[model samples]
Target: MNRLNMGRACARAGLSLVAMASLSAWAQSGAERLALAAAAPRLSEVVVTAVRAPQPLTDVLADVTLIDRDQIAQSGAVTIADLLARQPGVELSRSGGPGTATSLFLRGAETRFTAVYIDGVRVDSQSTGGAPWEAIALGQVERIEIVRGPAAAVYGSDAVAGVVQIFTRQGDGPFTPYVGIGAGNRRTGKLEAGFSGKQGALDYSLGLQRDMSRGHDSHPGSNPDRDGYRQTAASGRIGLRLNEAHRVDLTGTYTDMDAQYDGFLPGLDDHGLNRLATLGASWTAQWSPAYSTRLSVSESQQRYEMVPTPPYLSRTRLRNYLLQNQWKEGAHTFTGTLERREDHLVNAPIDQGRHQDGLALGYGYVAGAHTVQLNLRHDRDSEFGGQTTGGVAYGFAFAPGWRATAAAGTAFRVPTLYQRFSEYGQPALLPEKGRNVEIGLHWGQAASRLGVTLYRNRVSNLINFGAPGACLSPFGCFENAGKARLQGLTFMAAHQVAGVNLSASLDLQQPKNLATGTLLARRAQRLLKLAADTRVAQWRLGAEWHLASHRWENAANTSRLGGYGLVNLYASTTVARQWDVLVRVDNVGDRSYQLAQGYPALPRSFFVGLRWTGR
Candidate 1:
């Protein structure tokens, strides 16, 4: 089925659901809605990555989402991709079960367009031009910040779609320890242990975990052998305070995994070793009440090795240094930043390196019912002489609990080493460039929040395989495709009805190649997500649903992948003091589906776990 008809059908279905919910809400008395609102907890207020500094989410005139630690624990999701799939303006396509290659698309943008960061360090690989989404474990993350728009004016290149920043867990209050274990279908099991503490002027956090699963067959028809996956990960963070005006901090995360797959034939002999690690340090000084500066340095590495066949190895490393200063005067604030980054890659057959230096300036104003923000950045790359980008945003409050925002920005993504130097590569390929504009409306109170965003983005110089007559190189065939456009609508609402919590979102998007007028590959035109959770006495119960519209698997648009919906249920309770139990059932109906063609998704799985905490 084509997306146009599917999108309309999905739209009608979504409207029906909304009307039903509204009627149900109206059935309740006005006082009840007020009471429900008064009792519901407010969303997390503070965010750091949107502007590269600390600010309230409301103060930023951008489409954003913040997943806190408590939410992560309550969602009963095992991987970062699983959690991200539930967010608005986001979609995920995994090749197989856990510990497999997964790709994330934001607002109809390509996989490489969205930048990923561990803290403040950019972690996308220089070899593949994409982040290892499968390697990022959710157990070590304290929070995740998602900004769904162009941010290259504040960050460097590779922010065309948006940015995802992950913060590692840190210590709080007194010394505490935690341990957990789990067993589930497919012969899956897990072990986890961690400790965290805070002293007079110091804080620390450490964690270790391992997971193994004898997964279902990836190729159901031809391959009946069960694939397997194993992962061991560790993470730590430390902070030290020199005085009231100065502080220093260090953080590190590591993951090592082995995953089995079906190669040419169905055999257990095909496996790969993957490793990801990031380390960083930062020093912050408060020179005065209105002035402050920070200096940070970080390194990120990703390595993959395939065995039992023709051996293959590839590794990528990134090093970064940044210095920024912020000054505030009344309702006006200004910031200046300088950054340097180096990227190196080794793929056995080829080795490459590049460097980039960048500078950015930002200004913000907030007073009464108006807010304004502006940023400009210039970057000089070793290969691509220079590029400049800028952004401006304005927000206005017309009434209590209501606000409107408009923003426009430019962004770019540099070509990876494999795209430039390897066989079938094009060295003359230009970096992809894009411009985006969005307007959003937000309404919220303590009990409920509602948001809607409309956006349009245009991209040029897209890199792709060359046509029959477009190739000029003897060893490769690559060319710069003309142009593309992506337009979308995002709707989100959260409310606490009586004692139960309800949240829902819908995303409708159209991504087309300007030259051919064809939809982009692997991006659904419509998506819907709904979640409900509540606590009664010592028991917590939750349910989630995700629906996606039809999408094409290839640019030709002939190979269509049907839409699918999934339902999940979760329950947790405090069995004893400092001890808890969690149980979950995924794909409750065992509906057959596929996010990506030729890759089968898991079906009807069960998991149960126990956790203990001590102080």
Candidate 2:
């Protein structure tokens, strides 16, 4: 089937589902619909952390996208970043291979403005205030949910650009077990298996996975790096649908990984290692028809080791524990969450001193079509003081096929210990703050989905360069001396036809210095991204294109990187319900260009994978 016919078929099927849901909601009651999902053999409703609570995407007041496990399995990418790099408004930069330091940017904001989570746990490094995307492999993800635009109000800090959350495997069948082994180019090999079952009244799930890759060709660099990587991970879960009114679930995971890449620092052989562990639990109870309370708690430990200066092994550890609760009544939901993230790091530099942390409190609510969220935090360093951030969004369904949303928010970021205390890296700076507002509209949900949003963000207390030689180093002393402003538009459309999905997104941003009236350094003003996913009978194929505008690297505007385009292709097929094959090609034209100053991107390469899904 081609795209046109496939679209028609999907439209028919989707219309039926929508009608069924709307009619059911009107004929039955909210309680009945909730009960129906459990009795029905097919699951058509999936709630996500996109909203702090269980809400359907179509009913959400914000723009959200979901990439399920089936899609992840076909991408044939090795890392979580690899899979998400194809997202509409996202761009990524990595120091090396999987398990190294990496950054993810959304819209036109820097990595520090984006928040990433795994099962509701903040996984970013407190020492740097950025999640290292390269540290995560995409081997076992169940789903990835992405919400765009400023969301600090509901999610707390680092949400100026939006949020990305990944949900991993929970368990399988009442009692079952399975395993698989595979290999490919780069001397890569994978070993994985898991089993779970019910012991009378108790249920459990345990799984283990390991992967090693000799790696592929590295980017062209002065000091060539031989790409090689290894990852070992294990997770277990136990849950009891104890009774209809109460339930509890507990899950834990541990992962260790290592990788090598071009350090970009002269003559330095870059290498890094990461060890991570997490334990989380969720408990829920119903007190009445319109009242229910859910309690969730999680503890995570993350440590990173890098040989920026060989043999001088250093480590940064993040120990985070959080408790959150939610109470729901009718269309009103209130949430109170307290998160304590204790960060301890030893930079081990001549002028660098050890740094540590305190905690932050976050609270938010969703009542009817209005949402409000806030975060107040205090750090070990007081100059930054107690920082408060939040946002509010009001939305309404104006008519059939039409939804409008208006929102405003403010957010702040304290300078990372790396940016403030690192002897070799500190830029001499204070914290940063920004305020922004946006209005957006959405049209059509099934046959076609289209959205447009306009936003403006203004920043102050920016950490920037002072008079050239005044500072001890040439990098300049950091202070909140200047202001920065950013404005942008995001346009997205999705049309699924005849088993094919055509999705496109375009973003145009202008970031400038309010003081000097010049463009901000190295920020892309225009970015265009598009992707097409198709399934022809048993074979599925996908393609993506990225185009970026020129950008500058400094206030002087002496250095610049030319605009560029990138294209990729992927194809896969299912041999049976239990097995499948994948082939992916990236950088098809092998165009050489800098993704960032002094840093080049990967050249043309291919990846092949074999997968076995659920039994």
Candidate 3:
């Protein structure tokens, strides 16, 4: 089918799903709805990344999503990127299978535009301008928070598109230990163990995981050998409650990954090595009922290298310090923060370092039916003088379980050190800036919910590779020669019917480059997702459907990437009073597709695992 016909078909399908959801909601009896609501667990009611502080989900004015530990386990995803791609307004691209180069686009923005944090500690690569998603182990994460819009006003830089925060397990209650083992196709295997507990005034949690796989050939046209990978990861969190008003916390994580891939020289064996480590420490004090303060220090190290014939190595180290104060009185809350960030990069002939000092102020109000939030921040960079950003949001609860929200924000991202000092760099390039506005209507009651959001974000001073002129490389030079407009409408619905939980989301977007009047590379104009889950006897079963419209492979719109659909299924059950069993199958149809031009998507695969928890 042609692109136009495919797009129309997707649109019709989306409409049909929406209609079905509405009809089901209307047909449900009041008693059934109430029963569904009563049975629902209040697991994810509070989120912190939306406003840099913990707030109830209903009071938040920004677009956000929360994923709990149970959701993570049920996802049956091999990597963090793979799980994130299942979310609305998010997309993923990979050059190969697990433990390979990967990119995530939030709201159709570049990977670097999204700021990522692990346990309140920032992790980024100055060489690539984004986090190393492939190196981060998914088994160690306990919770995830995603904010889906520009947030430079809250975070200093690298937040033009959104912000993502990952949290490791924290200890509570009595001592608990768990172990899990799994095996799958492609000679894949995994083993994980963890323990968490709180004793007296101290709490601690630690986990370890290892994974290995003989993956498929990523680039079949080049080398025919089976690409393989191995990974090892560990995470720990410890907290000390000195007193009722004072506390201290420490968090750390480390991961090492080695993957074999086809290089330029086909016959020879080549490998890529990646390592990441992060450490953070913080202290908090509550002086009074209305006042509190926190101080934190964190550092992250990232290194990547290619072996043998094409020897290459790059390392990035980032350090952050923050002092925060919060005051609360009646229905108003205020915050003041002072932060410092230092970045250092070592790549071949270039070793560079830079620092930024920032001050931020914020205000939030939640009274009766009205909610408001405002934020302002200023950062002085060692190389680029100063940049200021601000945002405002307002929400009004007009009726029972109905709310209207409007928000506008400004964001910016400074050029990476490698983008300035490398062989293809340009020292005089300006920082990229973004302006965004959005409005949403949401209604929620019990187990039924609906939301519609419309948004438009424009970016200026965009950077692209152009003809060689101001750099040492003859092939091309980095230049600020592009502009982009990303506009979209998203619809989401959730309803329970006949003991089954149903959810659907549709995203219609236009991510276009103004310079060439064409669609951005690897971004679809339409996306739809549907999911259903139910429990029968002793087993819980779930299925997911994912669909996307056609996309362009390049900015010129010369090459086309066909759209595809995939079905995934998962089932879990508990037995022997202490063991949990899970089975999952992905790409059920064995459909052939590609995320990148040359790379092939993973075929139909199955995995089964057994986990035991000490009671």
Candidate 4:
């Protein structure tokens, strides 16, 4: 992370500004705009889960954000990270460019504590935890619903931070198909297509997309390597319904990704590869109008290769299998989940393993203007066997269109493979565990949404990636160094005026270790985001700005990464009834900022694409 590498990211930001003026096509008449403006308030009525389940955002008793299809099309984004990076209480980072393994943090929680799901199926790592954001391309998505803050109530372990659920389309129509191809700077190319159809009582859909970048110098490569990255992915699903009493869904996905890190600087020349496959099926049926049940089962396998491919070096393998059942009766809802997971690692002559079987149960009810939920989980871990964790939550309607909520939960994190059995490194550390308490408020009306939340987390057995050494110098090790507390506030507000929509969010966190009286390094105490989106006729425009507070890279008084702010712009317009165009400029300030104080930040760049909106 030197200035030269910083400049590479800056260059990319500067290139995006020039792309905005190029939007606004000659087509897209005035009539279409009038039709949408009249039907705008009914936009949410199109969602199935929201309608059939009918859990109001405030009823969940937690802080949540829903990005519907309209917003996705309006943002003109090409990847999932693009949408998340602009959100409140979340930040995403990579070594340099797209298709690289991404890290996401919620509030001040670590990456592994967040859980990701695709169509109700868990997509996170079986061992390390957390989803690989780069592996999820945008082409196949219908909409995304993100529940931020501790979520031990509905989901299982590693949900101490939050849950991000993605729902792919299952073909809303019959025989609908689309294909697209595009290219950008640094030899970036994209190919994507999907089709949906139905016959009688059954409906099905499939989609595929690939993105590749022969990236530029977002950093000064030690060996003048081109810093290349590529990803290929495809997903398919089938849905069947019988007489409105029974419903079934089956899904499958495959992804492969490769990136040449070439090390951000000298001696960091490591290449990484990740491949994953997932398959799952679910069934939901109604015994009557007042009582219903849902059941699902899934399996997934993922392999990680670092440095020199598989056989020649270090690698990690993860396998996960899960089952969940839920029953709804009157105002009462009960859910049960059972899962088995394994994480296997190989580092030369050293081997480490972790196996876990966990079950979680929850009950929720609505009384008067208040909603209450209770949760419990039973787990048997390889290192620590037979444990139960749970939480309680309450949401009360305070006033017209306003709700208040609070929750308290207990959670734990398993030890890393290297922490337990790295023969060439430290091997004595144990698991980390913690408790979280939070409170929030939510309010929404016709044209606006406002949400605010306050939370605190106390964690013990915090793992430390120990300092550089001779016997254990560059390779890194770990330990249960100390206990700490993280306290923060998250707030977001969005509103529409005239033809323009505006949104803003702020995340403030202070993490400290009581034992050492020191702030946790590389974790920012404050982050802020602001954006504006407006549409006129067929033309749409959006702009964003972000600022992050500085923090230490290490507590030993080594170095500090300075604070910086970055900006981005997006614009799009319809070309014809079937075609549309998009242009985006990211990191417009060309600021050389570090998300972790030293790791290289992404460079300034621009991307343009053509898409189709309807069949």
Per-model root-mean-square deviation over C-alphas: 3.9, 8.0, 3.7, 8.0
Least well predicted 10-residue stretch by lDDT in candidate 3: 23-32
Best by TM-score: 3
Candidate 3 lDDT over residue span 1-615, tens digit each: 344764575567556655765422211111122223333455226778877876666557788877779989998899999988888788888888888888998889989999999999999999988999988889989998888888998898989989989999999989999999999999989899999999999999999999999989888888878888999999999999999999999999999999887787888778889999999999999999999999999999999998976998999999999998999998999999999999999998889999999999999998877889999999999999899999998887777766778889999999998889999999998999999999887666677776767788999998888889789999998889899988777777778888998877777888888887888899998888888888999999999999988888877899988999999999999987889999999999998888888778788988998999896
Clashing pairs in 1: 37-447
User: Candidate 4, which ten residues in sequence have the lowest lDDT sum?
Assistant: 25-34
| lDDT: the better of candidates 1 and 3 | 3
What candidate 3 gets wrong by more than 4 Å, as runs, is 1-18, 22-44
lDDT of each: 0.82, 0.63, 0.86, 0.66
In model 3, pairs of residues that clash are none
lDDT of 2 at 584: 81
Query: Per-residue CA lDDT of candidate 4, range 372-454, in tens?
Result: 87878888887777757788878776666566778888877766665566532455565677788988765555555555567
Each candidate: how many clashes? Answer: 1, 7, 0, 10
Error of 1 at 238 (Å): 0.7
- Assess the local accuracy of residue 49 in candidate 4 as a C-alpha lDDT between 0 and 100: 26
**TM-score against native, each model:** 0.93, 0.80, 0.95, 0.84
Candidate numbers sorted by TM-score from highest down: 3, 1, 4, 2
